[model samples]
Target: MNDVTSGPDTPPLTKALKETAHRLGADLVSVAPADRWSEPPSFDTSTVHVYPHSGYTPSELMPSTHSVVVVAVRHLDGVIDSTTTDTKTTAIQGNFGYVLLNRKLNDITFGLAHWLEEQGYRSVPLGSAGQSRYNHRADDDPDILSVGYGVFSLKRAAVLAGLGRKAKNGVVASPELGVRMRLGALLTVARLESGPLLEGDPCPPDCTICMKACPTRAISLGGRVSHLRCFTDVGRRGVRYEEIKAKFKAQYPVDLPDVDYVDKEYWGNEGTGNRMCKIACVAFCPLGKRRLPDVMRRVKEFEQQRPKVELLSFPPSHEFALDAVGEGNSAAEPSGSG
Candidate 1:
């Protein structure tokens, strides 16, 4: 009744059924007990204050409803890589890659929802914040109701469903996708078994590729991030920083002489605000390696490639958490203007 028992029919019933769903294009699928989803931490204001990415509003419908179904759609790393070489390509790919992947995830969620509904149970699909047009400038005041019933964020739902633990980068990485997968959820009142979260830092301790690769130094040694700095760097030119600046100033004449204008002007002249760091860091992680040493080697390769900043990206002792990069307890100045 609770867990799927392995009776003769059980093997055919559960394994065959789940495999068929995968054949229908579900990348990573899990059936979590509805109880596990009750009181998701995004609803906690304190937790939200600490982690701002959770959608602003809490859901009233799905939490009270039933069983939670979650799915992951693998993001195409090839397309993500194309963003680095060509700016036009980066813009085009970055914009569409996330969109396309999420759509696929939604489609899968809908497929699962309908499949569940056919079995005489009601179902709901988790909504996306990036898809919602509401102003999220106020991170604390998210429109939870607009996100609506049955839909859960890939970020929050993944951790709660026991798929994976949260990373310092604030992404959910699995042995399968690392941080490269997109998440979607389905809500149903049905009974199903859930998988256990993978243990330890799928990322190794010696691996600091993401940190060293960050252009803005947005990733902290302690696994903390300064989002504003990361965005500003991306917005301005971290990629073709100098090239972007020249193109922008040529396109527009500047008359104002304020700090904001100056900053804008500086960013315009130099192509300094692209997410090169994020691209580089993620592209180089050891997750895809055949062994931990391979990942560690990749991390070292990144460290060697990095230009020495005041603070270097170092590995955390524990697999799951991140610590700042330094010898003892010394802290570096926060990366950017948040």
Candidate 2:
């Protein structure tokens, strides 16, 4: 890479990168010193591991990784909120949007990487890891969902990048996006000004909305998250989606289906079909709720309108659906059929 800036002191170029990121669709952007990864995690560090192999650090991603650029895009509540339907097709429709959003975020990250490379600095973009790579486990575990490792933990990276703070729900909650954001990162040799970790917790000490909202009790009051419980429930939807897809293929062999089944990417790239159908944990959080009044109202309305079903009685093979209006509709009649 060749340097495009005037001299080695290129803070202006770093500023340009941030501006370009915003223009390229990033809702939140920040730069963190690569050294931040050297420090122990504010939470337990035992569960996290880096790739291409464990015991690696963010600085190891590139020998000259001077700064890490982190970006986040808000997951609009309406898009996720509308998918709470009992219809077998609900998960496919609702989660596809989230999948697309992640794709967009990756595109933006790569775009930033290319721009950095053009500026005479080496850049490496790290999107959500591929399923095969993300699912890879070291010798430590035999059980599923034992804190699966990745190229990097974007949430942890985002927090260190000063874009957000870790919340009790085990999510990086941003002031602008709350828990409703997806993060991506790019490592660069450019010595850009680094952002400081945001001070103070955004989550209310008295509130446990996320804990209560989780159907599987995945989140705890003490902020401990059972990755096993969360991943199992989330992954179960993918299994259900595959089953429905198989039946759909059998019943209408000749007709082309409108929606094809997408396997859930455990790395959180393409969400499982149940993504929106099970968003109560994130949607009900008060942080950044005021920014989207209509979204909050719709979520609340869906909660009131939707009939609750016992988790045990709900078929394990189906995505949990909430009775609610579709996107753009104010009201809708509940389905008579389960």
- Highest TM-score model number: 2
What digit string (tens of lDDT, one per residue) describes model 1 on residues 43-143?
Answer: 34332222233432223544434446667766565554454342333444445456565566666667776775665556676623233222223223222
Q: List, residue by residue over 30-49, the lDDT tens digit for candidate 2.
A: 98877777645443333322
TM-score of 1: 0.60
lDDT of each: 0.47, 0.58
In candidate 1, stretches whose alpha carbon ends up further than 4 angstroms from where it belongs are 1-17, 38-59, 84-88, 127-151, 235-278, 288-338
Candidate 2 residue 206 Cα shift, in angstroms, is 1.1
Per-residue lDDT for 52 in model 1?
34
Give the root-mean-square deviation of each candidate in angstroms.
Answer: 11.8, 10.3
* Cα-lDDT of candidate 2: 0.58
The collision pairs in model 2 are 2-120, 3-120
